[model samples]
Target: MSSSFDKFQKRRLISSYFSVVLSVFLVLFLLGILGFFIINSKKLADDFKEKIAMTVFFKSEANDSILKAFGGELKTAKFAKSYDYVSKEAAAKQHTDIIGEDFLTFLGENPLQNSFDIHLKADFVINDSIEKIEAGLRKNIMISDIVYDKQLVNLVNNNIKKVSMWILITSIFLTIIAVLLINSSLRLSIHSNRFIIKTMQMVGATKSFIRKPFVMRSVKLGMIGAGLAILALIGVLVYLEVNFPDLGILDDKLLIGIVLIVVFGLGILITWLSTYFATQRFLNLRTDDLY
Candidate 1:
């Protein structure tokens, strides 16, 4: 009878350990997905920012010397990424290419103005900042007009802001839900060991003495789960990199190391927290509640 009881207890312990491991694995998986988005969003936003161009059209009668000085000044500006000076002839040729040969022949002279194609830094693409940049450019005597898609820039900025906020809110909500789910799963796992806890308590085991083994088991389970989740994440990253070379920028070694460290740290923290609380609950349970 004693031998059978010990065997049954061993089976129950194994089952509880597996349950905890499975729950930790799921939590880590969710965390990995969240981390991927948070890591990539900034890069995507930067790429979009780089594409936003501000055109500075020069006066038709602006001399080469004045235009060169203006271009030099623009290069020195803090927000200017780079600038391309388009001469009147070049602009006319581009327009002729679009409209056909006879269009420019009908005109006595080139109607197209010289212009500077300006690329601004990512942070400077915001509406208010662009307004300031436009005002500053208007002060330049050589510039006749500053043209940029105000609506497009504003739309991109607003959409990015909205998406970022949505991601933040969604991540927070999902994290809370995941924690609760993991905690409940751990509670169930602990409840399965209620009889053992009661038996230990009856045998004069202190709360800490009874908690130590369970906590250690939880730590081991969490580590295993975290390792499995990390392997899966690595696989997904490799697949993405292979399939979409454009996303290869996300394969930075330092960033990958940081993600792995976060996953391991989260595993340890969640395991410790859940196990500690579950053990406390078991320790405070009455004999009648053990069943």
Candidate 2:
């Protein structure tokens, strides 16, 4: 009977250890997905920002010197990333190429005016800055009109703001849910060993002494989980970089390091917190409650 009991106890111990390991793996997997999004969020926002450009249309009869001056001034602007000078002939050719016919032949002359396609820095791609730049361009004598899809720009800006807020809120909500779920799981795991805890108490074991081994085990499990999560995250990032080279620009080392730190810290914190609370509850429970 003693040998059978010993074998059963050993099995239970191994099962509990594996259970902790599995839980850690699950937690890390969830965190890895979250971290990938959070890390790439800024890159996504910058891509949207870069797509917002300003078009400066010239007067039909504008002198070449006047157009050159306007382009030169815009080139010196702090917010301007680059500018493309689109000649009337080039614009007409573009239109013809798209239509696959000579629309210019019907007009007998190129009706398209020479323009500058202005690309702005991501920081200055906000709606207000674009509006301000448009207003500034209007004061130039060479400019016949400044054309941009104001509504589209506004929509993009608003959507970015909304998405950022949603990401933050969702991350927080999910983290809280994760903590609660892990805590409950730990409590249940500890509850299974209530008799062992009671027997320790009867033998004059202090609460700290009783909690040390469990806490140590929890910490070790947490570290292993965090390491697994980091590896999974790196694998996903590697896959993205290989398949989508454009995303490689967003592989910021600093941001990735920060994410790893946060993941490890979160794992340790959650594990410690759950273990502490579980042990506390066990210590406070009545002998009758154990039954």
Candidate 3:
């Protein structure tokens, strides 16, 4: 009977410790993911902004050198990220490919204009900045007209703002939920020791003396849980690097280090506080209240 009781107690100890660690691990993993998204939000916005292109068409009277010079000037512009010059012939061919017909031959002339497809940097891709860029482009005598999707640019900006705001709200909500869950789990783990706490009280043990072992155990569990979470997060980043190399999220070492620090620090803090409070409650409970 004595041996059976001892084995049961040992099993319960292991089970309680496992439960604490698993709960902390889950919460830490969630916060780590939130941190990753928050850090990469700028990169994502820039990527979407690159889709807004401006095509500047030139008049037939403009010579090749003049048009090329205008393009070179655009390269020096503050708004321009890059530009691709398309000859009239190439534009005509591209149009033909799209329409699936030789419209140039049918009309006995290539009506297409030499154009530059300009991609603006993220800073200058805003709607107001686009007007400034357009005004600057129009000042060039070699340019006939600048064409861009004003509505598309506006839509992209508005949508990106909405999405970013929503993501930030969601991350904050999930972080709160994760903290609560970890706190509750740690409290419950300490709650399981109510009887032991009462027994220690009957033996005239000091509160701190009784609580020290539990607090140290909780801290150890927290460290283990945080280490596991960091390892799991790293595994995910490695997978992304191998399979989705273009994402580039894994390249930011500073952001990765920040995430690891937050997870490790949070795990220890939450576990320590929860353990201390829960043990204090048990220590103060009357014998009948504990029952």
Candidate 4:
């Protein structure tokens, strides 16, 4: 009967450990998902910003020398990501394709101006930056006009700010909840072993000695949980990459690395701290409080 009881206790302890690990895995997985979403949202915002190109039209009499000089300046511009020159002929051809008719036949000449469609870097797409850029570009003698949808730029910027704010708020709230839940699980697990701690203390075991094993065990469990969470995150990313290639899950290695580090770091750090506090609570309690 004594041997059977000991075996039963061992199984129960194993079950408790498993439960803690499982709880931590779930929390960390959700946190990883949120982190991935936040990173991708930023990428999407930049993509939108970069797509708002500024079309710089040239004067009707602008010659090849002026065009070449302007093109060279655009190539070396600090704010420009890329630029594509569209001659009047090419522009008219594009217009013809769009309208499904040759406008040049009726007009007797190509009316489109030679222009350079300049795609700005993501960081320079803001209102102030764009205004400054336009001001500087307008000073060119051969440039006729610079045009882009200022309204579209404002819309994208405003919507991004709003979405980012809400995402930040939600992330903070969920992180707090995750910590509390993980801490609660650790406390309960520690609580179950309160008598063992008290007994070790009564036997003249040093506090450090008592803590070392529990802390190490908890750290190991935390590592296991974190590893599992990371694997799950990777699996999800793989599935997304395979099924929806356009989302570009596998393209940004740096962002994915950061997310993985965060998930693993949070798992280890939170679990260690929660376990330390949870174990300390039991270690400080009176024997009578163990009941």
Candidate maximizing lDDT: 4
> Over the full model, what C-alpha lDDT does candidate 4 score relative to the true structure?
0.90
User: For residues 1-291, what per-residue lDDT tens digits would candidate 1 score against the true structure?
Assistant: 999999998998787777777777887887887888788888778778868889888887799898889888887899898889999888888877887774667788778889999989988999889999899889878778998888988888889989999999988997787677667777887888788998999999999999998888778888988888888888888888888888664567788778878987878788888889998998998999877
Q: Candidate 3, residue 201: CA error in Å? A: 2.4
The regions of model 3 sitting more than 4 angstroms off are none
> Which residue ranges in model 1 land beyond 4 Å of their true spot?
1-19, 88-102, 105-109, 235-259
Report the poorest 10 consecutive residues by lDDT, candidate 2: 247-256
Task: Answer with 2 or 4, whichever has the higher TM-score.
Answer: 2
| Ordered list by TM-score, greatest first | 3, 2, 1, 4
TM-score of each: 0.80, 0.89, 0.94, 0.79
Comparing 2 with 3 on TM-score, the higher-scoring candidate is 3
lDDT of 1: 0.84
Residue-level lDDT for 45 in candidate 1: 86
Q: Candidate 2: where are CA atoms >4 Å away?
A: 1-15, 248-250
Give lDDT: candidate 2, residue 83.
Answer: 91
The stretch of ten residues in a row with the least summed lDDT in candidate 3 is 67-76
- Model 3, span 15-134: residue lDDT tens: 888988999898899889888978888888887787678999999999978987887788788778888999999988898899999897769988889989999999888878888878
Error of 2 at 243 (Å): 2.4
Clashing pairs in 3: none
Candidate with the larger TM-score of 1 and 2: 2
Clashing pairs in model 1? none
TM-score between model 1 and native:
0.80
Decoy 4 TM-score against native = 0.79
